[model samples]
Target chain A: MADSPIVGYADALFSVAEAEGNLSAVEDELFGFAQTFQANEELRSTLADASVPVARRLQLIEDLLDGKASATTASLISMVVSAGRANDLPAIVDAFVDRSAGSRNKAVATVRSAIDLTGEQRQRLTEAIKTSTGKEVEVKVVIDPSVLGGAITEIGDDIIDGSVRRRLNQLRESFR
Target chain B: MVASLVSLMSIVAFAGPASASGESVGSCVAEKFEESLHHHGESDHVTSDDIHHVAHDEAVQDELEACLEAPSPILPELTEIIWGGAAFLILLVIMVKKGFPAVKGAMDARSEKIRADLDAAEQAKTDAQTVQSDYEAQLADAKTESARIIEEARVTADQLRTDLSAQAEASIAEMREKAAADVEAQKAQAIADLRAEVSGIALGAAERVVQSSLDADAQARLIDAYIDEVTGSNG
Candidate 1:
């Protein structure tokens, strides 16, 4: 399994959560962390930089998930960082989320927002999407300020675009 | 002369049948003609006595009457007719057997030659007609062959024109296609360069504007409010 590092790491994290009876919490926390890691390229580069000591990278991951996530989630993330797989964190988190959703028979909806959504907003948006699509969805929101004012949602091949970025592109095209 | 006249008169008055009359008749006409000549010789002189004159008048009167209405001096007899008829028949027979046959043969030969000449003329006319018809047919064939050759030349010229036109059209089409492809490639290159430049400027400006407009707290509150509105409306 380790021959394919992306899948191997995802599987190991998935097993740890399942064994600890906290699969859902681990999936949510990993999804948030992967989003943050992608958003801040400086932080991601520093953590994934090979010049930094392996122990320092592990300590950084522990400090990141100290109070925000469950013990199993923290341990699994720390283990991936310790294994020197920080560069593959986003891909590994996606693999893990896909595996978790498939097991639960729910669809993955990746949402790009200007900031993190509140718990109440998350619940309502999920229920609203379920009602509209007639399928249970695990919504993963990423803070992307480039989207300007509105959120953009992608579910498989479908895109629900409500972003100022798209508007601006349309305006640029008209100018051309 | 008087005595001879009396004698000739007596013979003429009493001539016999052809048994002896041919000689007598011949001698009688000759003797009478001679005796009459002798009387004219004697009576040609004017009379000296009245009785002589009267006698001469009577003789002249008698001669005149004899000359006017006297009988034939020599009568035609049977023996003479038979001999004449026989001679005529002999002459006719000679003409019929020899002269007539020769003339008829010459006429037949002439007629046959004429007929042969007419046949030769007819053959000459037929041959002339055949020669004329053959000449006419040959002339007509020459005309038809000339016309066909001209038509073939025209057709070949037209086909050559068509082939040249088609080739020109194909060349023009190829040139137009190449020109269109070049234009399309240039347009695509321009579009790609413009897109790269525009996207970089737009992303930078947009990132700054959005970041300045909303902090994490404001973004979260706005998102929660939007979500709340959407859920409440649906319910």
Candidate 2:
């Protein structure tokens, strides 16, 4: 998660976001974009394909995040893509988010859900995780249909798998 | 006259003093009587007185005695000896001319026959020895050939046994490997079947529960319940 090149890129992105005075917004948007990049096989492959030409890859990044992300977030992703680091987009973004959370003395928890969490549900879930893990927590939600229902949360190496998918898998394993 | 002559000879023979030795006197008188008989035929018969006068002649009696007293000659007569020698020479000439060649010819033929028989016997002995040599050589060759055949048979039997043993071992190994493969395949198929059944049953039941019970209100309640459970466990 914290290889040297990935940390260096993350530190540079964090410094840029902080200098722009929109660290929180850029970090959140970048985290969500990274999740999208990881989820979409075509987007991940195209962005990482060195044969696609840097100009074309940059244009594809701009088109994908046009109005969906802040200008600062789009520019930072384009910078990473143009620099041929698009293949490490998820890792760099994760490192940046972790660094950002650490500055505020909190841990980052990536949560996968079948449905989008309400604002109240997010606050409650965050509070519950902070209590359970004994750390100030920042929750990042990834809408994943494969979760089936409920949620699966990953905080560092620990995973809290509460999804119906996990329950069904356990039932399958019992027969063996 | 002949009867008177014979009577007168008888009386004169008895009256002679020399007539006491009858063998000599009788032989002389018989000779004279045969002469007188031959000289005087039956036509000239003489009386008994005339026969007595002739018989009393002393000169005739002396002459007969003198003839009987003379010694005989030792040699045969020349004419008889000459004839006997001539006959013997002729017989010897015939034996030399005819008998000797025939005897020699017969003896030569007998000797030739005996020599021929000995040669034949010798030739037969040599032929018998040659036949014996050939038979011995053939017997030796037959023994060598039989020994060679037996060796070949032994080698062939060993090779056949080795080949059969190897084939049997290979067959056993192949069977064992095939059996193991079959067991493994069955185990894998059974596991897959069990997994599919469990997945169908568990997923079907879960899907039904989620679809029927997971309304907006129920979803909210479940989320709230999970939050409460986490906080309570940690606190």
Candidate 3:
């Protein structure tokens, strides 16, 4: 059967990394790169500016992800920047992550927190969500200070919100 | 010379003969000579002689000197005074008769003309003043008419505005009343529909209870009792 376009890209990248024997490392690095690109507006605008030379934009991607990502992941990001598809980078990465999760028969669980969780806290929260949902979940944690405190988790259409901002909004609504 | 010759001939004849015809001729010649001498002499000399001849010729010459020594009226001098006085009186009469009347007539005519002109000017001025007053009155009337029209228009506009506003308010009130009536009717209809549904459910429940509890004969008896009770009440 023919795979989806996003699945094809993810399979190609995964096969290449597996051939190099660095699939897990490349996947982790690409996940962080996708989150960074999603969070930074200025970086996104610079990469998406049509007027900026493609070569210069590639260089910026290299400078941002060179040391922090696997060589294969860095090269893949540069390739995407050079192709003038920087705006689609986050979508492509998200699709790739989803494809990778589907291959393992796990649901992609996106978790946003106001601060970084400790290793023990992350493992406990992941296990608790897996137990509650009765499914294996690939937890993708995004540290977002705008959440104020606590965490908000989304597994498909199910949202488990435990943030201070959400509590305050509910309190304000009850008064109104 | 003729008169002296006549006189000398008469004197010689009288002295020489006394004949009847000679004496008569001599007297006649003497009378003719005296008449001629009277004609020849000047009047002044004759007057002196008349005075002096009664006395003597030498005495008349003395009287003539005395008369010259005294003041006498000369003819030329008297004639000049008389003519000058007559000419002055004539000139005075001519001025009164002709020149004075002509001057008076001209003055009267000029004064009459001036009076007529002044009368005409006064009449023209009065006419002009009347025209000006008429124009002013017309202007005032026009202004008053405009003011009255403007006031009437303003009153009409205000009345129209008031009528429109009243109509709008009444229409809005009517709309509100219609909406309230419609809402009340809908509520009543909903209540009626709910009551009909509840009545259906109640009837179904009552039928189930009766069918489960009663047999066929007991149902027929209950129906007959219900009919008899209704008929007895009607009777």
Candidate 4:
């Protein structure tokens, strides 16, 4: 967790979703929404611009995800955005996923790529993360185009960087 | 002179007959003889005796006339003139004895008093000259002292003004520098604040773009590729 308050918010949202019997859908929706917010610059700008009041930001979230997500999931995100935590949404969601995985003695495998992963690939990647780290893992995929191409993975303290963006940055630094 | 001629005329007019003393005696004697003749007539009535008596009287009168007619027989008196001359000589001797010495002594005292007065006037003139000279010396010194004081005051005033001007210029320069520095500091601070605000906006916008690209479908695809790579590597 990045901060205690952020962790506290994550725990609180997790308990609410669990109690509603919609924990799986809530977590999945929240994780996917957080990734979308992190990836789209214009969308993030609209959501986080102080000129757009918090009320407006909340309304925007409702218009997009009101019926698409569970009431608890939508409400939790609306609460976070309305309470002025749009900038911290990705951190809060990541913390929640980590907490969820930790409940089952599993590590979180955060993956970034330009395209969505298939179910077989997710299964294989999870087993591979378990085999490499010698621990059980729950894979969470985040789509990012700034990855440009290829993929980057974060498992606990380890980072596997295979993204085209990293290669380009290395090339730039070398020229300098 | 006329009073003396009148007295001479009056003396000639009142003078007696030249045979007055004898005539007067002879007359008285004839008067006595006549008385006797009258007594004799009464006794004898005698006429020839009376005629003889008258003849004798005429002879005695002629003798008396001869004596009175002499002019050089009498002289004037001299005893009263001698007594007046002796009284005038005694008065002249009293004047010479006392009056001359007293007049001479008075003239000498008056001359000595005039000489002392002239000497006192000369001493007074000298004292006046010395007092005038001392006053002139003091007045000259005062004039010189006043001139020196005025000169010194003028110099001091000029220097004071010069020093004051320099101090004012220095103070003005210092204040100007301080004001310029303050303006520069304020300008730098405003730029720093704008930079921070701009950087925040840029970072937020970048984050939003990255998030927008990482949709669920894209995230799933990236997960699939990462899984293939990881498993393939292990295999």
- Highest lDDT against the true fold, candidate: 2
lDDT per residue (tens digit) for residues B12-86 in model 3: 544433333233444654554444446546352556555335344554445444434533355333444554455
- Name the candidate, 2 or 3, with the larger DockQ value: 2
Error of 2 at A13 (Å): 0.7
lDDT per residue (tens digit) for residues A2-99 in model 2:
79999999999999999999999999899989988998999999999999989998899889888988899999999999899988989999999999
lDDT by residue (B1-235, candidate 4, tens digit) is: 3334544554464344322432444565565555556644565565876646633565544544433444333431232223234333433344345444555566777777777777777788778888888888888989889999999999999999999999999999999999999999999888877776666566556556656675666655655666666766655
Instruction: Choose 2 or 3, whichever is better by TM-score.
Output: 2
Candidate 4 regions off by >4 Å? Answer: A45-55, A169-176, B1-229, B232-235
Listed per model, the TM-scores of chain A against the true chain A are 0.87, 0.97, 0.89, 0.86
Clashes of each: 0, 0, 0, 26
**What value does DockQ give for candidate 3?**
0.00
Instruction: Compute the interface RMSD for each candidate structure.
Output: 4.5, 2.2, 34.3, 6.7
Candidate numbers sorted by lDDT from highest down: 2, 1, 4, 3
Model 2 chain B is weakest, by summed lDDT over 10 consecutive residues, at B14-23
List runs of model 3 lying over 4 Å from the truth. Answer: A1-8, B1-169, B172-235
Top candidate, metric TM-score: 2
State residue B142's C-alpha deviation in candidate 4, in Å: 55
Show the colliding residue pairs in model 2.
none
Predicted structure 1: lDDT: 0.75
Q: In order, what DockQ does each candidate have?
A: 0.17, 0.29, 0.00, 0.15
lDDT of 4 by residue, A1-176 (tens): 38998998889888887789877788899998998888788878888788888787878888888678877888999888777787888989988888887877887888887666678777787887766667788878787667766678898788988775775556544433
Q: Name the candidate, 2 or 4, with the larger lDDT value.
A: 2
lDDT of each: 0.75, 0.79, 0.68, 0.72
What CAPRI class is candidate 3? incorrect
Ranking of models by DockQ: 2, 1, 4, 3
